[model samples]
Target: MKVKSAATQVHREQPLVLGYKVDIARQESVKAMYDSLVEVFNARLDSLINNTAQMEPYKPFLESDPDTYWRTWEVNIQGLFNMARTFFPMLSEQSLQVVYGEQGLWASCVNPGAIKIKITAGALEAVRNVLPDRLAIAGDTIAWLASDRKEWLGGRYISCPWDMEELVAKKDEIAKEDALKLRLVV
Candidate 1:
Protein backbone atom coordinates (compact mmCIF):
# COMPACT_ATOMS: atom_id res chain seq x y z
CA MET A 1 0.00 0.00 0.00
CA LYS A 2 1.07 3.58 -0.60
CA VAL A 3 1.70 5.08 2.81
CA LYS A 4 2.48 8.79 2.75
CA SER A 5 1.17 12.23 3.36
CA ALA A 6 -1.46 13.57 0.98
CA ALA A 7 1.14 15.57 -0.83
CA THR A 8 3.15 12.44 -1.51
CA GLN A 9 0.30 10.34 -2.77
CA VAL A 10 1.56 10.57 -6.33
CA HIS A 11 4.26 8.07 -5.55
CA ARG A 12 3.38 4.42 -5.36
CA GLU A 13 5.34 1.21 -5.00
CA GLN A 14 4.45 -2.48 -5.03
CA PRO A 15 3.60 -3.99 -1.68
CA LEU A 16 4.60 -7.57 -0.95
CA VAL A 17 1.87 -9.30 1.06
CA LEU A 18 3.62 -12.58 1.68
CA GLY A 19 2.70 -14.30 4.94
CA TYR A 20 2.52 -17.76 6.54
CA LYS A 21 -1.17 -17.75 7.35
CA VAL A 22 -2.09 -19.81 4.31
CA ASP A 23 -0.21 -22.94 5.26
CA ILE A 24 -2.06 -25.10 2.79
CA ALA A 25 0.21 -23.79 0.06
CA ARG A 26 2.35 -21.43 2.07
CA GLN A 27 5.75 -22.60 0.89
CA GLU A 28 4.92 -22.43 -2.79
CA SER A 29 3.06 -19.15 -2.40
CA VAL A 30 5.85 -17.58 -0.38
CA LYS A 31 8.46 -18.73 -2.86
CA ALA A 32 6.60 -17.14 -5.73
CA MET A 33 6.06 -13.92 -3.80
CA TYR A 34 9.68 -13.63 -2.71
CA ASP A 35 10.97 -14.54 -6.14
CA SER A 36 9.01 -11.66 -7.65
CA LEU A 37 10.08 -9.28 -4.91
CA VAL A 38 13.72 -10.18 -5.30
CA GLU A 39 13.48 -9.74 -9.01
CA VAL A 40 11.64 -6.41 -8.87
CA PHE A 41 14.14 -4.81 -6.46
CA ASN A 42 17.09 -7.01 -7.36
CA ALA A 43 17.02 -8.65 -3.94
CA ARG A 44 18.02 -5.33 -2.38
CA LEU A 45 15.99 -3.78 0.39
CA ASP A 46 16.27 -0.24 1.61
CA SER A 47 14.02 -0.90 4.54
CA LEU A 48 11.76 -3.69 5.72
CA ILE A 49 8.69 -2.65 7.70
CA ASN A 50 7.31 -5.75 9.41
CA ASN A 51 3.87 -5.00 10.79
CA THR A 52 2.66 -8.60 10.81
CA ALA A 53 0.76 -9.38 13.99
CA GLN A 54 -2.04 -11.17 15.81
CA MET A 55 -3.47 -10.46 19.26
CA GLU A 56 -5.12 -12.84 21.70
CA PRO A 57 -8.31 -12.03 23.48
CA TYR A 58 -7.93 -10.11 26.74
CA LYS A 59 -8.10 -12.87 29.37
CA PRO A 60 -6.24 -14.47 32.20
CA PHE A 61 -3.60 -17.01 31.15
CA LEU A 62 -5.59 -19.91 32.56
CA GLU A 63 -8.74 -18.67 30.92
CA SER A 64 -7.13 -17.79 27.61
CA ASP A 65 -7.50 -20.13 24.65
CA PRO A 66 -4.23 -21.92 24.05
CA ASP A 67 -4.69 -21.88 20.28
CA THR A 68 -5.47 -18.18 20.25
CA TYR A 69 -2.54 -17.31 22.52
CA TRP A 70 -0.07 -19.37 20.55
CA ARG A 71 -1.31 -17.88 17.29
CA THR A 72 -0.60 -14.46 18.69
CA TRP A 73 2.87 -15.50 19.77
CA GLU A 74 3.55 -17.19 16.49
CA VAL A 75 2.51 -14.27 14.32
CA ASN A 76 3.71 -11.28 16.31
CA ILE A 77 6.97 -12.68 17.67
CA GLN A 78 7.90 -15.69 15.59
CA GLY A 79 6.81 -14.02 12.38
CA LEU A 80 9.34 -11.26 12.92
CA PHE A 81 12.04 -13.79 13.69
CA ASN A 82 11.34 -15.76 10.54
CA MET A 83 11.15 -12.70 8.32
CA ALA A 84 14.35 -11.28 9.74
CA ARG A 85 16.14 -14.58 9.43
CA THR A 86 15.25 -14.82 5.76
CA PHE A 87 15.29 -11.17 4.66
CA PHE A 88 17.84 -9.33 6.83
CA PRO A 89 20.87 -10.42 4.83
CA MET A 90 19.25 -8.70 1.86
CA LEU A 91 19.64 -5.40 3.71
CA SER A 92 22.08 -3.16 1.94
CA GLU A 93 24.68 -1.44 4.06
CA GLN A 94 23.00 1.41 5.92
CA SER A 95 19.60 -0.26 5.51
CA LEU A 96 16.95 -0.62 8.21
CA GLN A 97 15.00 -3.41 9.84
CA VAL A 98 11.99 -2.09 11.79
CA VAL A 99 9.47 -3.93 13.93
CA TYR A 100 6.69 -1.38 14.37
CA GLY A 101 4.49 -3.40 16.73
CA GLU A 102 4.40 -0.75 19.38
CA GLN A 103 3.59 2.09 17.05
CA GLY A 104 1.60 4.91 18.60
CA LEU A 105 2.80 3.17 21.73
CA TRP A 106 1.93 6.12 23.90
CA ALA A 107 -1.71 5.42 23.07
CA SER A 108 -1.80 2.05 24.88
CA CYS A 109 0.32 -0.68 26.47
CA VAL A 110 0.01 -1.97 22.90
CA ASN A 111 -0.67 -4.85 20.61
CA PRO A 112 -2.56 -4.71 17.31
CA GLY A 113 -1.91 -1.11 18.17
CA ALA A 114 -3.92 2.04 17.82
CA ILE A 115 -3.20 2.21 14.14
CA LYS A 116 -6.58 0.79 13.22
CA ILE A 117 -9.71 2.33 14.65
CA LYS A 118 -13.32 1.31 14.78
CA ILE A 119 -15.22 4.42 13.83
CA THR A 120 -18.22 5.24 15.98
CA ALA A 121 -19.87 8.59 16.47
CA GLY A 122 -21.87 10.13 19.28
CA ALA A 123 -21.22 7.05 21.33
CA LEU A 124 -19.19 5.95 24.33
CA GLU A 125 -16.01 5.70 22.34
CA ALA A 126 -13.42 7.10 24.68
CA VAL A 127 -11.31 7.78 21.67
CA ARG A 128 -7.69 8.43 22.42
CA ASN A 129 -7.36 11.97 21.20
CA VAL A 130 -4.11 12.48 23.11
CA LEU A 131 -0.63 11.21 22.30
CA PRO A 132 -2.22 10.05 19.09
CA ASP A 133 0.48 9.10 16.69
CA ARG A 134 -0.88 10.12 13.33
CA LEU A 135 -0.34 7.77 10.44
CA ALA A 136 1.95 10.42 9.02
CA ILE A 137 4.11 10.29 12.11
CA ALA A 138 4.64 6.58 11.68
CA GLY A 139 5.36 7.04 7.98
CA ASP A 140 7.79 9.86 8.60
CA THR A 141 9.56 8.00 11.35
CA ILE A 142 9.98 4.95 9.15
CA ALA A 143 11.41 7.10 6.40
CA TRP A 144 13.77 8.74 8.89
CA LEU A 145 14.89 5.36 10.11
CA ALA A 146 15.41 4.20 6.56
CA SER A 147 18.07 6.87 6.18
CA ASP A 148 21.75 6.22 6.77
CA ARG A 149 22.01 8.31 9.92
CA LYS A 150 19.54 6.10 11.77
CA GLU A 151 21.43 2.88 11.04
CA TRP A 152 22.25 2.45 14.72
CA LEU A 153 18.50 2.26 15.38
CA GLY A 154 18.44 -1.03 13.49
CA GLY A 155 17.91 -4.51 14.97
CA ARG A 156 15.57 -2.98 17.52
CA TYR A 157 11.98 -2.57 18.47
CA ILE A 158 11.32 1.07 17.60
CA SER A 159 8.51 3.12 19.03
CA CYS A 160 6.97 5.29 16.34
CA PRO A 161 5.91 7.90 18.86
CA TRP A 162 9.19 8.30 20.72
CA ASP A 163 9.93 11.91 21.53
CA MET A 164 12.01 13.07 18.60
CA GLU A 165 13.67 15.98 20.35
CA GLU A 166 14.58 13.84 23.32
CA LEU A 167 15.84 11.11 21.07
CA VAL A 168 17.86 13.61 19.09
CA ALA A 169 19.32 14.97 22.28
CA LYS A 170 20.27 11.50 23.38
CA LYS A 171 21.25 10.21 19.97
CA ASP A 172 24.91 10.13 20.85
CA GLU A 173 24.34 8.33 24.11
CA ILE A 174 21.92 5.94 22.44
CA ALA A 175 24.43 5.03 19.79
CA LYS A 176 27.23 4.81 22.30
CA GLU A 177 25.28 2.65 24.69
CA ASP A 178 23.69 0.68 21.87
CA ALA A 179 20.37 1.47 23.43
CA LEU A 180 16.82 0.87 22.14
CA LYS A 181 17.88 -2.36 20.52
CA LEU A 182 16.04 -5.61 21.25
CA ARG A 183 17.66 -7.37 24.18
CA LEU A 184 16.85 -9.63 27.07
CA VAL A 185 18.07 -8.15 30.32
CA VAL A 186 18.68 -10.42 33.25
Candidate 2:
Protein backbone atom coordinates (compact mmCIF):
# COMPACT_ATOMS: atom_id res chain seq x y z
CA MET A 1 0.00 0.00 0.00
CA LYS A 2 2.95 2.34 0.44
CA VAL A 3 3.65 2.44 -3.29
CA LYS A 4 -0.03 2.81 -4.06
CA SER A 5 -0.30 5.54 -1.49
CA ALA A 6 2.71 7.26 -2.97
CA ALA A 7 1.13 7.06 -6.40
CA THR A 8 -2.09 8.52 -5.06
CA GLN A 9 -0.18 11.31 -3.35
CA VAL A 10 1.68 12.18 -6.54
CA HIS A 11 -1.59 12.17 -8.44
CA ARG A 12 -3.19 14.48 -5.90
CA GLU A 13 -0.04 16.63 -5.74
CA GLN A 14 -0.47 16.49 -2.02
CA PRO A 15 2.95 15.18 -0.95
CA LEU A 16 5.65 15.96 -3.46
CA VAL A 17 7.78 12.90 -4.26
CA LEU A 18 10.76 12.99 -6.58
CA GLY A 19 11.81 9.36 -6.74
CA TYR A 20 10.79 5.99 -8.08
CA LYS A 21 8.53 3.74 -5.98
CA VAL A 22 9.30 0.20 -4.86
CA ASP A 23 7.98 -2.18 -2.22
CA ILE A 24 10.71 -3.15 0.18
CA ALA A 25 8.91 -6.30 1.27
CA ARG A 26 9.68 -7.85 -2.10
CA GLN A 27 13.43 -8.46 -2.15
CA GLU A 28 13.71 -8.75 -5.94
CA SER A 29 11.54 -5.73 -6.57
CA VAL A 30 13.45 -3.60 -4.08
CA LYS A 31 16.81 -4.91 -5.29
CA ALA A 32 15.88 -4.08 -8.87
CA MET A 33 14.53 -0.73 -7.85
CA TYR A 34 17.61 0.22 -5.85
CA ASP A 35 19.85 -1.25 -8.52
CA SER A 36 18.22 1.00 -11.05
CA LEU A 37 18.45 3.86 -8.64
CA VAL A 38 22.16 3.25 -8.26
CA GLU A 39 22.70 3.02 -12.02
CA VAL A 40 20.48 5.89 -13.05
CA PHE A 41 19.99 8.21 -10.12
CA ASN A 42 22.71 7.34 -7.65
CA ALA A 43 23.81 10.92 -7.38
CA ARG A 44 20.32 12.13 -6.50
CA LEU A 45 19.86 9.96 -3.45
CA ASP A 46 20.55 12.38 -0.66
CA SER A 47 18.40 10.56 1.87
CA LEU A 48 16.86 7.13 2.39
CA ILE A 49 14.16 6.61 4.95
CA ASN A 50 12.98 3.15 6.05
CA ASN A 51 9.42 3.34 7.27
CA THR A 52 8.71 -0.25 6.31
CA ALA A 53 6.57 -2.22 8.75
CA GLN A 54 3.79 -4.82 8.86
CA MET A 55 1.80 -4.98 12.05
CA GLU A 56 -0.93 -7.12 10.56
CA PRO A 57 -2.64 -10.11 12.11
CA TYR A 58 -3.21 -7.65 14.90
CA LYS A 59 -5.35 -10.14 16.71
CA PRO A 60 -4.88 -11.78 20.09
CA PHE A 61 -2.16 -14.44 20.37
CA LEU A 62 -4.68 -17.25 20.19
CA GLU A 63 -6.37 -15.81 17.14
CA SER A 64 -3.20 -14.48 15.51
CA ASP A 65 -2.11 -16.24 12.34
CA PRO A 66 1.43 -17.53 12.06
CA ASP A 67 1.57 -16.36 8.44
CA THR A 68 0.81 -12.85 9.53
CA TYR A 69 3.59 -12.96 12.07
CA TRP A 70 6.03 -14.24 9.48
CA ARG A 71 5.04 -11.62 6.95
CA THR A 72 5.24 -8.96 9.60
CA TRP A 73 8.73 -10.04 10.55
CA GLU A 74 9.72 -10.25 6.92
CA VAL A 75 8.69 -6.69 6.20
CA ASN A 76 9.25 -5.02 9.51
CA ILE A 77 12.50 -6.64 10.60
CA GLN A 78 14.17 -8.48 7.73
CA GLY A 79 13.15 -6.14 4.96
CA LEU A 80 14.24 -3.11 6.90
CA PHE A 81 17.57 -4.74 7.63
CA ASN A 82 18.05 -5.64 3.99
CA MET A 83 17.22 -2.16 2.74
CA ALA A 84 19.60 -0.56 5.15
CA ARG A 85 22.36 -3.00 4.26
CA THR A 86 21.77 -2.61 0.51
CA PHE A 87 21.66 1.16 0.62
CA PHE A 88 24.44 1.77 3.12
CA PRO A 89 27.09 1.84 0.42
CA MET A 90 25.10 4.24 -1.73
CA LEU A 91 24.82 6.91 0.93
CA SER A 92 26.88 10.11 0.85
CA GLU A 93 27.98 11.89 3.95
CA GLN A 94 27.27 15.41 2.67
CA SER A 95 23.55 14.90 3.41
CA LEU A 96 21.71 11.67 4.00
CA GLN A 97 18.39 11.03 5.75
CA VAL A 98 17.84 7.91 7.79
CA VAL A 99 14.59 7.57 9.70
CA TYR A 100 13.21 4.55 11.54
CA GLY A 101 9.57 4.85 12.57
CA GLU A 102 9.09 3.00 15.87
CA GLN A 103 5.41 2.03 15.35
CA GLY A 104 4.83 3.72 18.69
CA LEU A 105 1.77 5.47 17.29
CA TRP A 106 -0.24 2.42 16.31
CA ALA A 107 1.02 0.67 19.43
CA SER A 108 -0.48 3.48 21.47
CA CYS A 109 -3.74 3.43 19.55
CA VAL A 110 -4.65 -0.07 20.77
CA ASN A 111 -4.67 1.19 24.33
CA PRO A 112 -7.75 2.63 25.99
CA GLY A 113 -8.04 6.42 26.51
CA ALA A 114 -5.40 7.20 23.96
CA ILE A 115 -8.07 7.98 21.39
CA LYS A 116 -11.82 8.37 21.44
CA ILE A 117 -12.20 4.81 20.13
CA LYS A 118 -9.79 1.95 20.70
CA ILE A 119 -9.53 -1.80 20.53
CA THR A 120 -10.91 -3.22 23.76
CA ALA A 121 -10.50 -6.96 23.37
CA GLY A 122 -8.35 -9.79 22.04
CA ALA A 123 -4.72 -9.76 20.90
CA LEU A 124 -4.92 -6.09 19.96
CA GLU A 125 -6.45 -5.30 23.31
CA ALA A 126 -3.38 -6.48 25.17
CA VAL A 127 -1.37 -4.30 22.80
CA ARG A 128 -3.01 -1.24 24.23
CA ASN A 129 -0.70 1.76 24.62
CA VAL A 130 -0.80 5.27 26.01
CA LEU A 131 -1.59 6.65 22.54
CA PRO A 132 0.17 6.59 19.29
CA ASP A 133 1.66 9.62 17.67
CA ARG A 134 -0.60 11.68 15.43
CA LEU A 135 -0.32 11.28 11.66
CA ALA A 136 0.42 14.97 11.20
CA ILE A 137 2.95 14.83 13.99
CA ALA A 138 4.82 12.05 12.27
CA GLY A 139 4.50 13.61 8.82
CA ASP A 140 5.45 17.08 9.93
CA THR A 141 8.23 15.80 12.13
CA ILE A 142 9.67 13.85 9.22
CA ALA A 143 9.53 16.90 6.99
CA TRP A 144 11.26 19.01 9.56
CA LEU A 145 13.76 16.30 10.25
CA ALA A 146 14.68 16.04 6.57
CA SER A 147 15.61 19.66 6.44
CA ASP A 148 19.17 20.87 6.99
CA ARG A 149 18.16 22.12 10.40
CA LYS A 150 18.00 18.61 11.75
CA GLU A 151 20.87 17.08 9.82
CA TRP A 152 22.69 16.31 13.02
CA LEU A 153 20.04 13.66 13.66
CA GLY A 154 21.31 11.57 10.79
CA GLY A 155 21.20 8.11 12.35
CA ARG A 156 18.53 7.93 14.98
CA TYR A 157 15.04 6.69 15.69
CA ILE A 158 12.66 9.63 15.40
CA SER A 159 9.42 9.30 17.28
CA CYS A 160 6.71 11.39 15.60
CA PRO A 161 5.29 13.26 18.57
CA TRP A 162 8.53 14.37 20.22
CA ASP A 163 8.76 18.12 20.09
CA MET A 164 11.40 19.18 17.57
CA GLU A 165 12.34 22.30 19.45
CA GLU A 166 12.58 20.34 22.63
CA LEU A 167 14.76 17.82 20.89
CA VAL A 168 16.87 20.51 19.34
CA ALA A 169 17.43 21.94 22.76
CA LYS A 170 18.52 18.51 23.88
CA LYS A 171 20.62 17.90 20.79
CA ASP A 172 23.80 17.84 22.75
CA GLU A 173 22.39 15.22 25.05
CA ILE A 174 20.97 13.33 22.13
CA ALA A 175 24.14 13.25 20.08
CA LYS A 176 26.29 12.60 23.08
CA GLU A 177 23.92 10.33 24.93
CA ASP A 178 21.98 8.80 22.06
CA ALA A 179 18.85 9.89 23.86
CA LEU A 180 16.10 9.25 21.35
CA LYS A 181 17.76 6.54 19.32
CA LEU A 182 16.11 3.11 19.46
CA ARG A 183 17.57 0.57 21.84
CA LEU A 184 16.63 -2.72 23.49
CA VAL A 185 16.83 -1.41 27.02
CA VAL A 186 13.67 -0.65 28.95
Candidate 3:
Protein backbone atom coordinates (compact mmCIF):
# COMPACT_ATOMS: atom_id res chain seq x y z
CA MET A 1 0.00 0.00 0.00
CA LYS A 2 2.80 2.40 0.80
CA VAL A 3 4.56 1.55 -2.45
CA LYS A 4 1.39 2.16 -4.44
CA SER A 5 0.80 5.45 -2.68
CA ALA A 6 4.34 6.57 -3.40
CA ALA A 7 3.99 5.53 -7.01
CA THR A 8 0.80 7.52 -7.29
CA GLN A 9 2.47 10.61 -5.88
CA VAL A 10 5.41 10.24 -8.27
CA HIS A 11 3.10 9.78 -11.23
CA ARG A 12 1.22 12.90 -10.25
CA GLU A 13 4.44 14.88 -10.15
CA GLN A 14 5.91 13.22 -13.26
CA PRO A 15 3.30 11.80 -15.55
CA LEU A 16 5.90 10.31 -17.86
CA VAL A 17 6.92 7.91 -15.09
CA LEU A 18 5.29 4.51 -14.76
CA GLY A 19 5.53 2.27 -11.78
CA TYR A 20 4.75 -1.38 -11.13
CA LYS A 21 5.33 -3.55 -8.14
CA VAL A 22 7.08 -6.84 -8.85
CA ASP A 23 9.18 -9.43 -7.07
CA ILE A 24 12.34 -8.92 -9.10
CA ALA A 25 13.85 -12.14 -7.74
CA ARG A 26 11.23 -14.09 -9.62
CA GLN A 27 11.76 -14.50 -13.36
CA GLU A 28 8.02 -14.68 -14.00
CA SER A 29 7.40 -11.39 -12.26
CA VAL A 30 10.20 -9.76 -14.22
CA LYS A 31 8.75 -11.10 -17.45
CA ALA A 32 5.37 -9.72 -16.53
CA MET A 33 6.96 -6.34 -15.87
CA TYR A 34 8.65 -6.49 -19.23
CA ASP A 35 5.37 -7.29 -20.90
CA SER A 36 3.66 -4.38 -19.26
CA LEU A 37 6.47 -2.01 -20.18
CA VAL A 38 6.45 -3.25 -23.75
CA GLU A 39 2.72 -2.72 -23.96
CA VAL A 40 2.95 0.84 -22.67
CA PHE A 41 6.13 1.95 -24.47
CA ASN A 42 5.72 -0.05 -27.67
CA ALA A 43 8.71 -2.22 -26.82
CA ARG A 44 11.39 0.47 -26.80
CA LEU A 45 12.83 1.85 -23.59
CA ASP A 46 15.35 4.68 -23.43
CA SER A 47 17.02 3.67 -20.20
CA LEU A 48 16.84 0.98 -17.55
CA ILE A 49 18.26 1.60 -14.09
CA ASN A 50 18.55 -1.40 -11.77
CA ASN A 51 18.76 0.24 -8.37
CA THR A 52 17.25 -2.53 -6.28
CA ALA A 53 19.69 -3.53 -3.57
CA GLN A 54 19.64 -5.22 -0.20
CA MET A 55 22.24 -4.38 2.41
CA GLU A 56 22.30 -6.28 5.65
CA PRO A 57 23.67 -4.55 8.72
CA TYR A 58 27.43 -4.96 9.06
CA LYS A 59 28.29 -8.34 10.57
CA PRO A 60 30.93 -11.02 10.32
CA PHE A 61 30.19 -13.68 7.68
CA LEU A 62 30.23 -16.45 10.30
CA GLU A 63 27.88 -14.48 12.52
CA SER A 64 25.39 -13.47 9.80
CA ASP A 65 22.26 -15.53 9.25
CA PRO A 66 22.56 -17.71 6.18
CA ASP A 67 19.10 -16.85 4.85
CA THR A 68 19.63 -13.10 5.18
CA TYR A 69 23.04 -13.17 3.56
CA TRP A 70 21.80 -15.14 0.56
CA ARG A 71 18.68 -13.02 0.30
CA THR A 72 20.97 -10.16 -0.62
CA TRP A 73 22.46 -12.25 -3.40
CA GLU A 74 19.00 -13.18 -4.70
CA VAL A 75 17.85 -9.59 -4.75
CA ASN A 76 21.08 -8.11 -6.06
CA ILE A 77 22.49 -10.65 -8.49
CA GLN A 78 19.55 -12.79 -9.56
CA GLY A 79 17.29 -9.79 -9.83
CA LEU A 80 19.78 -8.01 -12.06
CA PHE A 81 20.16 -11.03 -14.30
CA ASN A 82 16.39 -11.44 -14.67
CA MET A 83 15.86 -7.76 -15.45
CA ALA A 84 18.68 -7.54 -17.99
CA ARG A 85 17.75 -10.73 -19.77
CA THR A 86 14.09 -9.75 -20.03
CA PHE A 87 14.60 -6.11 -20.99
CA PHE A 88 17.60 -6.29 -23.32
CA PRO A 89 15.57 -6.48 -26.49
CA MET A 90 13.42 -3.52 -25.50
CA LEU A 91 16.30 -1.13 -24.87
CA SER A 92 16.78 1.56 -27.49
CA GLU A 93 19.90 1.21 -29.59
CA GLN A 94 19.94 4.72 -30.99
CA SER A 95 19.94 6.58 -27.69
CA LEU A 96 22.58 4.58 -25.76
CA GLN A 97 25.90 3.20 -27.01
CA VAL A 98 26.72 -0.45 -27.67
CA VAL A 99 27.36 -2.66 -24.64
CA TYR A 100 27.95 -6.34 -23.86
CA GLY A 101 29.81 -6.50 -27.19
CA GLU A 102 26.57 -5.93 -29.03
CA GLN A 103 26.55 -3.47 -31.92
CA GLY A 104 23.15 -1.88 -31.36
CA LEU A 105 22.64 -1.86 -27.61
CA TRP A 106 24.43 -0.14 -24.76
CA ALA A 107 24.79 -0.91 -21.08
CA SER A 108 26.94 0.52 -18.32
CA CYS A 109 27.14 0.05 -14.59
CA VAL A 110 26.92 3.04 -12.22
CA ASN A 111 27.89 3.34 -8.60
CA PRO A 112 25.86 6.12 -7.08
CA GLY A 113 27.81 7.26 -4.04
CA ALA A 114 26.16 7.16 -0.66
CA ILE A 115 24.02 10.26 -0.25
CA LYS A 116 22.67 11.86 2.89
CA ILE A 117 19.70 10.00 4.30
CA LYS A 118 18.01 9.91 7.62
CA ILE A 119 19.55 7.07 9.58
CA THR A 120 17.76 6.07 12.72
CA ALA A 121 19.75 4.55 15.56
CA GLY A 122 20.68 1.11 14.24
CA ALA A 123 23.62 -0.98 13.14
CA LEU A 124 24.43 1.46 10.32
CA GLU A 125 24.16 4.51 12.59
CA ALA A 126 27.74 4.24 13.77
CA VAL A 127 29.00 3.83 10.22
CA ARG A 128 27.82 7.30 9.19
CA ASN A 129 27.79 9.85 11.93
CA VAL A 130 27.27 12.55 9.35
CA LEU A 131 26.51 11.89 5.70
CA PRO A 132 28.36 14.44 3.58
CA ASP A 133 27.08 13.87 0.05
CA ARG A 134 23.95 15.50 -1.28
CA LEU A 135 21.32 13.60 -3.25
CA ALA A 136 21.89 15.80 -6.31
CA ILE A 137 25.41 14.51 -6.73
CA ALA A 138 24.23 11.08 -7.79
CA GLY A 139 21.02 12.21 -9.46
CA ASP A 140 22.71 14.74 -11.70
CA THR A 141 25.51 12.35 -12.59
CA ILE A 142 23.03 9.65 -13.63
CA ALA A 143 21.03 12.16 -15.65
CA TRP A 144 24.18 13.22 -17.45
CA LEU A 145 25.12 9.61 -18.15
CA ALA A 146 21.71 8.92 -19.70
CA SER A 147 22.16 11.85 -22.05
CA ASP A 148 23.22 11.52 -25.67
CA ARG A 149 26.90 12.34 -25.17
CA LYS A 150 27.74 9.44 -22.85
CA GLU A 151 27.88 6.72 -25.48
CA TRP A 152 31.61 6.32 -25.12
CA LEU A 153 31.18 5.22 -21.48
CA GLY A 154 29.21 2.09 -22.32
CA GLY A 155 30.48 -1.10 -20.62
CA ARG A 156 32.47 0.97 -18.11
CA TYR A 157 31.91 1.42 -14.39
CA ILE A 158 31.04 5.03 -13.55
CA SER A 159 31.32 6.45 -10.08
CA CYS A 160 28.85 9.26 -9.51
CA PRO A 161 31.18 11.21 -7.21
CA TRP A 162 33.78 11.73 -9.95
CA ASP A 163 33.86 15.06 -11.76
CA MET A 164 32.21 14.43 -15.12
CA GLU A 165 34.29 16.99 -16.95
CA GLU A 166 37.57 15.62 -15.61
CA LEU A 167 36.44 12.09 -16.32
CA VAL A 168 35.61 13.11 -19.85
CA ALA A 169 39.09 14.59 -20.11
CA LYS A 170 40.60 11.21 -19.31
CA LYS A 171 38.32 9.16 -21.51
CA ASP A 172 41.06 8.37 -23.96
CA GLU A 173 43.38 7.13 -21.23
CA ILE A 174 40.60 5.15 -19.56
CA ALA A 175 39.63 3.43 -22.81
CA LYS A 176 43.25 2.71 -23.70
CA GLU A 177 43.91 0.99 -20.38
CA ASP A 178 40.40 -0.54 -20.02
CA ALA A 179 40.14 0.95 -16.58
CA LEU A 180 37.13 0.91 -14.21
CA LYS A 181 36.58 -2.78 -14.69
CA LEU A 182 36.81 -5.50 -12.11
CA ARG A 183 40.29 -7.01 -12.48
CA LEU A 184 41.92 -9.73 -10.42
CA VAL A 185 45.46 -8.80 -9.47
CA VAL A 186 47.87 -11.71 -9.27
Using lDDT as the measure, which candidate wins? 3
Q: Which pairs of residues clash in candidate 2, taking residues 3 or more apart in a chain or in different chains?
A: 60-123, 105-132, 105-133, 111-128, 111-129
Worst 10 residues of 1 by lDDT: 103-112
Ranking by TM-score: 3, 2, 1
- Over 35-116, each residue of candidate 3 has an lDDT whose tens digit, in order, gives 9888887877877778777776667768888898788789989999998888776674444433745445667778777664
Model 3, CA-based lDDT: 0.75
lDDT of 1 by residue, 54-123 (tens): 5454556688788876766776676666655555556533233433333211111112224533321222
Model 1's number of clashes is 0
- lDDT against the true structure, per candidate, is 0.52, 0.57, 0.75
Candidate 2 wrong stretches, greater than 4 Å: 1-21, 93-95, 98-133, 149-155, 175-178
Candidate 2 vs candidate 3: the TM-score winner is 3
Per-residue alpha-carbon lDDT of candidate 2 for residues 1-186, written as tens digits (9 for 90 to 100): 464687687785444444657667777777887777766764456555675455564556798798877877888777877787677556543234543343111111111122213222223554555444445566566556555435456446556666668878987887888654555766
CA error at residue 35 for candidate 2, angstroms: 2.5
Top candidate when judged by TM-score against the true structure? 3
